[model samples]
Target chain A: MSAWGMIKTIIFGGSTLAFFFILWFYNPFKHVEHYEVEKDVKAIIDNPWKKTESGKTIAEEGRELFVANCSSCHSLRYDGIYIMSVQTNPKWKNIEKTAGRPVYRYGKLYKDRFFVPKDVYEAFAHDDLQSLKASFGQVPPDLSTIYLARGEGYLYEFILNPQKVLPGTSMPQIFNPQFDPQAKEKVAKIVAYMKSVNTPPPQEQFKRTVMGVVVIGYFLLMGLLLWKYRQNLLKRLGYH
Target chain B: MGLISKFIDWIDERAHIREIYRTQMVEYKVPKNLTFPYVFGVLALVTFAIQIISGIVLLLYYKPSIADAFDSATYSIMGEIPFGWLFRHIHATGANFFMAIVYLHMFTGIYYNAYKKPRELVWIVGWLIYFVLILTALSGYLLPWGQLSYWGFIVTTEIPGSLAEAPIFKDFFKAVAETIVLWMKGGYVVTDVTLGRVFGSHVLIYPLILLALVGTHLYLVRAAGISNPDGIEYDKKKNPDKFVPFHPYITLKEGAYVMWYLAIFFFFVFFHISHFLPPDNFEPANPLKTPPHIAPEWYLLGYYEVFRSIPDKFWGFVAFNALLLLLLLLPFLDWSPLKSARRRPLFFILFLIFMFSSMALTILGTMPPTPQNAMLGLIFAALVFGFFLSLPIISIFEYGWYKMKTKGGQKE
Candidate 1:
């Protein structure tokens, strides 16, 4: 091969390697540690009402607080209301199993019924806040995604004083620790529960071993191809 | 009979597949001097194929309704489905690369003056492809229902509202613009109805149009034959060695480039998926609360800068589309006898300046809109406009000067 041709190929191959190496180091898809709520900050004055537990333990306590307080308005799970409705309704079994069927025919009604359990129907009344909607003219947003959309910091402040954080907002301050004892502990548990509900599953980081194998395999095949095409490549480059 | 041969014969008899392949793939001739820039044409097709396949997979999980669109796209596609992030990243980043490759192909064609004489139709079809592609990308941008996408649509659609302010036929013009914008959104505001219609147009209507245009473009390329890189017309009798068959020779060269291109593509997909993303898009759309700053994807920012720089809204709308109009008029406007910039010193310098100005304007568009920045934007916008406007006059002048200097001067 001409010196110029060899130089060009080396430059191209080296740049390609360098480019991918940069991507390997700077990858956005690398596993990112998600946000988690802090459960305990030591009270400066040793407040007697504090739980003084780790965040996960506090969230465990918060589950009961959330069901009693937040469940009347904000839903805990995504589509919890829909699932509750499906359990009580009787027409859940009519959906066809045929392939290529138009999906809208099942509508919102029948689709949820397919997944509802028979025991759930007998256990609870339809749990959605339909009456709240009748009075307010707006259904409250589901809280399944609250921790994700607004970080734990916002949730803590909003719970303490809704009017102070967001003026003219519909949400009222539901807890006053001074007026009601144990309100502070209950609020902490609810915040912890909100954080626990929506934390994403951790991503598997891209493996260097797998990439090394793929690159080595690719280059091996490429080297063989280059050897096979040496004559044709030279001829095409006008060396002949 | 062998099983493979039987299957091939069955399909081949029904479709005449081999005949089509032999004619289109095997016998086609490309210029021997074709280089990396030439490969972008096929690279564009490669990226576009990636987009369509990944897009189809995404559509299976994506809900078009307002309430569900954001959650469905984010939760189902990114959080729920297996390897869903991979598909979503490929589709999103593939769209950007498709436009990037198309831009490279278009600019390379311009630098070589490929639109001269016999290839005007190919050039026109390319512009049309670009137009459809912009609309497709814009419509697709809103499907995520994020703050940036919502605001970007609002700003772009409001450009039409400027038409109402025109002097002579102000009311009629305003009515027409409003009607078109409303038709696009299916309402006065960007809501679930807007999302549904935009999604429909993005996946269904625009692709159909783009497919037809691309078919015509490829047919024209085969008909006209690939242009010589140095801008000399191909003559078989003069040097038959200058042409090579597409299948093995050109195909092999392009295959290597495709490998390199895919490496770059995967680099963005893996590491820099957010390279084109505005951070504001992480927040869901809130009609009551507008983001502090708004901008488009980087590719369209140059024109967006021009639009924002103009204080007069009516003139800004006119100027925005007029830039595209200038591109459409390029073949006729450039009256130079010479075809390639390689032989033209003055034009090459000007082209460099034009490219720099365009890049600068794009960067400037992302900065806070201040008077000083706006002034710079206006200056760059004028330079870009002048570059297109002066093409014919400059070509004529330069060619005349060359002829005067050397009576025997001829383009090699």
Candidate 2:
């Protein structure tokens, strides 16, 4: 090889190594939280407010409290608790048409069973973003997917003091200790409920694991076959 | 001898299949001196195939509208559809790999002087394909309607808007810039209409242009024959030993390279998916809230740094585009009779400078645009431009020196 070629190789190889090293050191997405529902459930169960004197699970009590306090704005659609009325209702038939058949069926199965108040459902079904913003200063986000996006820790902090966690947030401190004495327990339970509902179903995990294994294995096998075939061909060509 | 042979014979009689195959594949001759770097072009084609297959699968589930685009792309496909996550990762990672391979292929072409003489059209067409690929990538990046998608779109589309600050024809330039940005965004701002426009262009328009350009590029390659690493033109009839048929030799080699590429590609798909997906992109588009740090994907970072390095926005935009234009005009700019840099120390040094400066600029692009970084970026950007602008002069000197050495009883 020429001196230039050697220099090129050294520079390319060194840069590639340096790039990978930087990627390892920085780890750009290191802070991204990966939620595991079972771990969260175990944590909730081990908490001091695991069960109320009424013998309710934390998640169960959280659900009741969420409906009374938070459900006026936020909807738990992942838990089959959409704020919108049932798809079968005449006023909501357009949602069925727009959302397609599967979603309509989902709405039919879940929306009818969930007991959202008439007024709240009416406001949501009418697509009343203007009034919602006027009331809360901003339209509230759906809580169903929030657990996965923000994680339990951030949610706990945000719920405990909305202004401190996210200044100018539309959400008020609903569980303020000045107004509600059981603020800490309520925040814990709400987070627990969020975890319970938003935890990915086991089938999703199984599918990802199985698919990843199969794909990687197939590629490995193919690569080995190709490597063997290449060696044979090179030998036949008198190049080995 | 059985059904397959009979079927092939039936088709051959009607379509002249044997003649086509013999001309395009069986009798096609590639230079024997070609090394592993030669595989990068074929690897690029393979990566494009991966992108097309995976992209089509993604399109089946991708929603183009703003409201549902994020949910459909993320939750509906990744969380609901079977093996959708695999295809999504494959498509995303394949794009990155595609750019990497194309860069390697282009560098290989430069090293071998593959763009000289009859192969200029091949280089030009290949560059067009590359340019359109960048467009397709930029447009597709916005389809998911993530925060990065939206904000990245804003940053890229707003590049031309820097013309508003141009020293000449301030009013007219400002109007033209505004008009161009508006047209690109499909409105005064990036909105659902912009998403629709990008979706149409990304999947349909750019791919069609790329396909045509790639076809032309391949045809040009075949017509011109492969350039050898030694940069010496050899007649196949005069030196038959230096040539080999493309069928078993080239095809099998490409297949082996592809198999290795696929292994590494799948490893990224399965394990290092986060390498392609930035964390800020996890959030859906919020026009009101801009992420603190926004950068284009790694492939475009060099140009992005060139744009950022200059103090004046108008000049930065000019320099940014001038860099790409200079690269496209490389065959014409470097007028040396000798194609390869192997024997020419000046050309070799210039190539290294170009390569190092571009790499430096790319690294600078990813860093925060502080004054010191910007200063470094400016210097590297100047080096990149300097390499191209000085190429013709250096080529003249090298040619004169080569003549002197050859005249001094040196064997050509």
lDDT of 2 by residue, B1-412 (tens): 6999999899999999889889878688878878778899989999988998998999999888876787677666665576677788899899888888898798778877789997998999988998999999999999888888999999998999999999989999999999989888888877778888899998989988988888899888888988888888889999988888787777877776777778778878876776686656766787887887898988898999998889999999999899889989999998887878666678778888887787778777777788999999989998989999998998888789878878899845
Q: Highest lDDT, which number?
A: 2
- RMSD values for the candidates in order, in angstroms, are 8.1, 5.0
For this target, which candidate reaches the highest DockQ against the unseen true structure? Answer: 2
Give the DockQ of candidate 2: 0.25
DockQ of predictions, in order shown: 0.09, 0.25
What would the TM-score be for candidate 2 when compared with the true structure? 0.85
Q: Name the runs in model 1 displaced over 4 angstroms.
A: A1-200, A203-240, B1-23, B190-193, B276-279, B402-411
Give the worst 10-residue stretch by lDDT in candidate 2 chain A: A100-109
The sequence of per-residue lDDT tens digits that candidate 1 reaches over residues A144-227 is 556556666667767767887778777778988679787665776677666544432122323423443465456455545644
The top-ranked prediction according to TM-score is: 2
Please provide, for model 1 over B196-306, each residue's C-alpha lDDT reduced to its tens digit, 9 standing for 90 to 100.
889999999999999999999999988888887677887756877887667667666666666666766766665566555434565667687787667787679888899
Q: In lDDT terms, how accurate is model 2?
A: 0.76
